[model samples]
Structure formats: C-alpha cells, structure tokens
Target: MKLMHVDASPKGAKSNSRMLSGQFVEMLRERIPALSVDYLDLAQDPPPHVSGDFARAIYTPEEERTPQMRALLEPSDAMCRRVLAADALLFAMPMYNWSMPSSFKAFLDLIVRGGVTYIAGPDGYAGQLARHKVLFLTTRGADLRDGSPFAGMDALTPALTHGFGFIGVRDPWFVDAQPLQFAQPEERAAGLARAQAELAMVADRWAADVMSEAA
Candidate 1:
C-alpha cells in the first residue's frame, strides 16, 4: 500500500507531532513490509497559496481552459493527484495559536479544489477522494479533550476533521500529545509514552485493514 506522511511543523525534528507520525510509519512498516512511504515536510516545501488565477481557472470548463489557466492550476492538480494515489495519509500537525500553521492551511487551499477534490451533488457536495483513510498526529501546548475546559479552544482538530470530512476522509484517527508545555516532567513522559502506545496499536490495526483491503 502507498502511505503518505505530511509534516506541517516548522519546528523540524524537534516537533513532537513529527516524532509520533514517524513512529507510526515505522511501526506500520514493520507490520506491512510492502508498504511504500512518501514524506512531505510542509515547512521545507509548502504548496503555494491559492490565488485569483487559481479561482478563475477552476471556474473555467476543463476542456476550454487556456495555457494560463492550466499553468495556474497545475500545482493544485498535482497535489490532489498525490492524495488520490495514496491508500492512506497521515498528517503530522502542531497547533499554533490554537489553529493549524499557516503553511498547512495554504497546503489545504492548494489541494482542496472545487472540481478536482470535490463537486456538487444531487444531495450536496461530494468528495472525490473517498475511500482513502486518514490519520492525524497532533501536538498542542494544552489539553483540549472533549471534557476539558479548553475543549473548544482547539481550533486545530475541529477544522482538520471538518475540512477533511468535507473531502470524504471520514472519521480520521487522531493521536494527540497535549499539555506538553505545562505538564510536569513525569507527566509529560507518561503522556508521551501513552500516546506512543496508542499510535502503535493504531498502526497495527491500520496495517491489517490496508493489507486486507488490498488483497
């Protein structure tokens, strides 16, 4: 199976989200030796933000699009193709100011094209990238679990799930490293260990699911 890992942290190697996502991939690799991995570090190579040209190009009929329109939409089309090619996609995300990093948002904007990724349906909008599984590895400075006082404070998970769900990546798994900056050393260690275990289990289940589906 083809697995893609996208890291959105500018923190580079020091990013906890990056660590956990890599760990998940490594564990999955061990379980499914045939798995092929693709990695994208958005901080190092982020997609260009959508522009007026992009909007205009997508609005134009495909058969009638000119060279200028194709040129404007080429990058977005490539990004969407990569997503459609992947059997599973794992996003390594860090919460910045209660929201996703700007680079990640830009990446989303580039790929989530109207006709390329989604389209109007008889009922409503329908995503073109259906049947692909998604897993999110996320890090935050504070706890924002459902029962926590800071529940709605997390702008990351909600937007991530909603946006991806809109594209038909339904019920994506999430591994959260939370309150890392505020928790005591022991607490932080314990939290990391717990998340690691959770992710390992997820990897195992995901491998079984993907391999069985492929077979």
Candidate 2:
C-alpha cells in the first residue's frame, strides 16, 4: 500500500507531531515491508498559496484552459494526483492559535481541488476519496480533554474533520496530543505517552488492513 505522510510543523526536530507521525509510519513499514511512502514536509517545501490564476484555472474546463493556466496549476494538480494515488494519508502538525498552521492551510488549499478531489452535484457533493483512510496527528498547547477548563474549545479538530470529509475522508482518525506547552511537566509527558500508544494501535489496524488488501 502507498502511504502519503505530510509533516506540516515548522518546528522541525522539536515538533512532537512530527515525531509521533514518523514513528507511526515506521511501525507501518515494519508490519508492511513493501509499503511505499510519499513524504511532504511543508516547512521545507510548501506549496504556493492559492492565487487568482489558480482560481481561474481550476474553474475553467480542462479542454478550455490556456497553456499558461495549465502551467500555473500543474503543481496543485500533481499534489492532487498524489493524494488520489495513496491508499492512506497521514498529516502531522501543531495547532497554531487554535487552528491549523498557515503552511498546512496553504497545502490544503492546493490539494482540495473542485473536480479533482470532490464533485458538486445538483443533489449534493460527493467525495472522490471515499475509501481512503486518513489520520491527523496534531499537537495542541492546552488541554482540551473532558472536564478540563479548555474543554469544547478545540476548533482545529472539527475544522479538519469537515474539511477532509468534504474531500471523501468521512471517517478520518485523529490523535491529538494536548497540554504540551501549557500544562505541568508530568501532564505533558502523559499526553505524549497517550498519543504514542494510540498511534501504535492505529498503525496495527492500518497494517492489518493493508495486508488483508494485498492478500
């Protein structure tokens, strides 16, 4: 199976999300020896933000698009093709100001194409990647767990869920490590541990699915 792993953290080696996401990918590799990986590091090589040219190009029918329009949209189109080719997707990033980082948001803007990733039908919308599995690994500054003062304040989770669902990942998995920056030392460690443990289990399940498909 092909797995597309995206690291959206600007912190590089200091990013907990990256560490956990990489570990999960390695676990999958261990289980599925032939698993192919496509890695994109947003911090190192980010796609350009959506521009007027992109808007014009995407809305224009492919047959009618000018040469310049096609060139302008080629990068975005390639990103879309990568997503479609991948069997599973993994996104790792730290929440910034209660939402996604700007780089990751820019990346999403490029890949979430209209006709390419989803279809807006007369009745409703349909996702093109309905069968693809997706995982979001996020690190949050504050604790948003049940009974915490910050409970119900996780705006990032719902936004990601809906955004990805719109593109056909209706049941994407999320493993969020919170209270990393604002909690006690022990609490941070505990949260990290919890995220790692959950990721291991998720990797197991994903690997099993891959093996089943191969069989």
- TM-scores of the candidates are 0.93, 0.95
Model 2 residue 146 CA deviation (Å) reads: 1.6
Error of 2 at 128 (Å): 1.1
Candidate 2 clashes: the total is 0
> Could you give candidate 2's per-residue lDDT for residues 81-161 as a string of tens digits?
999999899999998988899998898889888789998899788889898889999999899889999887888998899
> Which portions of model 1 show Cα errors greater than 4 Å?
none
**Model 1: ten consecutive residues of lowest lDDT:** 179-188
Best by lDDT: 2
lDDT of 2: 0.90
The whole-model C-alpha lDDT of candidate 1 against the native structure comes to 0.84
